[model samples]
Target: MRKEKRSSKVKDALGSLTQDLIDAGLGSPFTEKELNYYGINIPEIKNISPKKIKVIREKAQFSQSVFARLLNVSTASIKQWEQGTRNPNGATKVLLDLLDRYPHILDYRINKSKRKNYI
Candidate 1:
């Protein structure tokens, strides 16, 4: 629907989505049109090519190592995010999903209700 709308709810949904995807494979079993619905292209992330994760790093001009460090993860981790060999699980996936929709705002805070944030 809208950025605000997705932002407000997707975080909650993504954990389940991530689990479903882990169980099924890349959002396939989840039946979320947001991930993949053939005819209807969901507006925002439709253009962000799957592991357009590489694009995210490039657009931000971040070397994989640097971006990985920014995420408090290893360079290999960023490489995995780029290559799509391994899915970013737990909190990382949430961050990446947020990044996919709003690339520039990756570093912003999302779990505002939680205290003491990091990375």
Candidate 2:
């Protein structure tokens, strides 16, 4: 009756939400990017030029140190990456690709950190 219909609707909503969370956590094919943490045939990352690196940082509106902090990399590593002496690899490469494609996603984390500090 009505109870069964309501229960089914709730289940459907929960199922959709669960799928969205999984898609967000694992990535959707729509992004054309996947991070296989098991070290399988990972997708190739495009070569990042010095100018592109600078652009990415500027686009994120983060200073080198803050960017490094967000990336969990050392400031020296950011400097080297920007100077073309080194390149991001592994998870760093994946993360950079994600950020390059979805810059606004960082806003949540940055805002959350600021809130944490204020508290």
The best candidate by TM-score is 2
Q: Would you give me the overall lDDT of model 1?
A: 0.62
- Cα deviation in Å at residue 67, candidate 1? 0.7
Expressed as tens digits, the lDDT of each residue in 1-119 for candidate 2 is: 69999887876665565457665786334222222322123347877887788788888889999899888899999999999999988888778778888876676657564455543
TM-score of each: 0.43, 0.57
Prediction 2 global C-alpha lDDT: 0.74
Candidate 2: worst-modelled 10 consecutive residues by lDDT:
31-40
Give per-residue CA lDDT, model 1, range 1-119, as digits (tens): 99999875765576556666655745444355644422222334222333577876777666787678767899987776667676566667666667656776755433447657575
Clashing pairs in 1: none
Candidate 1 clash figure, as a count: 0
Clashes of each: 0, 0
